[model samples]
Target: MNVVTRSAGIFLLAMAAIALPGCRPASQPSGQIITLRLSGWQSNPNEKQRLDYLLRKFEKTHPTIQVKYETINSEYMDVIKTRLIGDVAPDVFYLDGFEAPLLMQYQVLEPLDRYITPEFNLADFEPSLLNAFRYRNQLYGLPKDFSTLALIYNKQALAAAGITHPPKTWAAFTVAARKLTVDRNGDGKIDQYGFGIAPELARQTFMIKAFGGQLVDQNGFATFAAPNSLRGLELIVNQYRRDRTAAQPTDVGATWGSEMLGQGKAAMVIEGPWSIPYFKETFPALEFGTAEVPAINGKPGTMAYTVAYVMNRKTRHKEAAWKLIAYLTGKEGMKAWADQGLALPARRSVLGELGYDKNTLYAPFVAGARYATIWQAGKHLPTIRMNFNNQFISALLGEQPLSDAMQRAQDTANREISWAN
Candidate 1:
């Protein structure tokens, strides 16, 4: 059967499974617990505390069911994939929206529609974000938290450069970056850079979209060779080569852009809302503010990354698993998590409750959600990313022309997709 038909079949089977008596294991002498495993990557101390509190509440509400939480410390995605392939995956686990398409294509995730009740209210989530986890009309995941990119700048750096506010247009940004960049000690060695760009798939994907370029076409083919896309790549490379105002975090062995900015080595960077809390805890003395990512060619844009709680297709305890998923994503759980203000809430009402709608620091990020381009999750995402990285780095090093590099990257990515098919 085709994908949609197969998805429908799965949904029907799930419904049948839920409806039939004896679907769950024997009631364990009426009082024993029904244990389920929930897995996710590591979280901060505060987040862990909150999760523990929520889990305790869940256990109290459903005394018969017990959840065993597990964590993978290293190579989380690889570990999760290996477990899924080995048929030992957790009943419920964290799934990034970008990876949902791949998991759905492999038919490894359970369709959630069968379990969603009237109380679930799937419509409460942002439609575009919810659509990210839905494949062939079957929802595979429910978003728990989300983040969008914004320009984070040092107030002192801008003042020293005679700038009063963050730049709003590409032209103004370029000017400010040049002025803010300096060889501070005048020893011909640059002590401070105007900006640092994180040289990763996520940041580059945002750059491509900001310039009105689609990384993949409607048919799920790589399409980064368009002129607009090439211009976007050029903009990044030129900042390092021509403007001399930007450097990649890798050049300094920093894993994230936020770290580069936190150290006071860079005056500006584009990062997500998560960085705010991270910096607040890591370096309370640093002074900074966030602004919407400057428009490129007069268009507002940014990149949004989100993760959802999903069920495994092979989960034997479907009912118990649904209950756990529901509680984690429900109004109560969402409010508890979002109240910490570490990440943006995926639910609309929870965002308002958390004061994100009125907080000026968070308002731009929420506003950008409507225009932000989401990362793609085509079957060939891994291969496409590899090629894009290689070619992008080559352009950054002046080893190839922007157009030539992008064309070669596109060709390589398309070939990989063809091989996969």
Candidate 2:
């Protein structure tokens, strides 16, 4: 162990000296009153307030335990890694699915298998989501919440284009997009784009998998340059370059897809559940509806983004940390947090109780969980993702052919991962 880790371990043993005092009352609890630190990126102000309220309830339920919550926003992973190396990291913290593999490989995370009990009901979580935190047959984290991509469209725009319903398949979606791309007032400038695209690998991974494309081989080298992968990606590039119907956020000077929609620059977008809360709060007057992602090559596909809570292996208050994690991801706490609709619950029971299955606005996202492609892979995924995003955007902008771009992306990613290993 390094000096920092050794010091932390020594401090943990030193803390045991003051575990119990002789002056303790008979009615008092046997264990020491401990404070467990939890770290995560905070959402918007309102959502952060809701989480604070929920944590307060947990503290009340377990009188002997106190939660010291901390929020890290900018460069989250960089700060977290520094803290971990210094042995000053929080006892529990949020880990994105895409980043989990690197941390797991370093063995910095506590394997949660032994901490989980039957009553905790590990099976209640969606298997696809839960599997993201598992490595080498050991569970390293519990997913707190998740969001899956779906088609969000403007109702009035579709009606103006003489379309009564959203597209159900890729072919029909293509037609709808063409019709929705509008040029009002004959200004020779487009008024609204057919679709707003992010053009990042985080959103395009499912498209790569839609046409029998494997993102990576068992050896974790990038396989996205394969013919099958280009076949699926060709549609996106063609739409953006040839059809002139689709546009990215920068084309309209918007920050993201949600901003493009809220500003009426795009008629449709493929986004996640967070869009609902955003639309309601920022553009309540805008009429919108959501539907399941259109099928690709007769196969249902979408992307799922998730974050999980994991324990630090160096934590001194292991039992207390587990108690906080268990409560935060547990049924009651999940229901309280997910009721706000900022994101969907990872737990089946919480989702059912929230009635998202019956609500039309939320139903499509709930249904997508069954076929959503989780945005996670091996430890080399970060390298692969960076190269793909850079090269794929070149294709989207008509600066390069899709096939050539992906070839360069795959080759570069493999070279970088090889150097990293």
Candidate whose TM-score is highest: 2
Q: Candidate 2, residues 289-340: lDDT per residue as tens digits? A: 9999999999999999899999988777777778889998999999998898
Name the regions of candidate 2 deviating beyond 4 angstroms: 1-31
Q: Rate the local accuracy (lDDT) of all candidates.
A: 0.80, 0.87
Clashes of 2: 0
lDDT of 2: 0.87
Task: Compute each candidate's TM-score over C-alphas.
Answer: 0.90, 0.92
Error of model 1, residue 114, in angstroms: 2.3
Q: Give the Cα error of residue 153 in candidate 1, in Å.
A: 0.5
- Predicted structure 2, TM vs. truth: 0.92
lDDT of 1 at 201: 68
Error of 2 at 165 (Å): 0.6
**Candidate 1 global TM-score:** 0.90
Please give, for residues 228-260, the per-residue lDDT of candidate 1 as tens digits.
Answer: 777776777888888888887876567778888
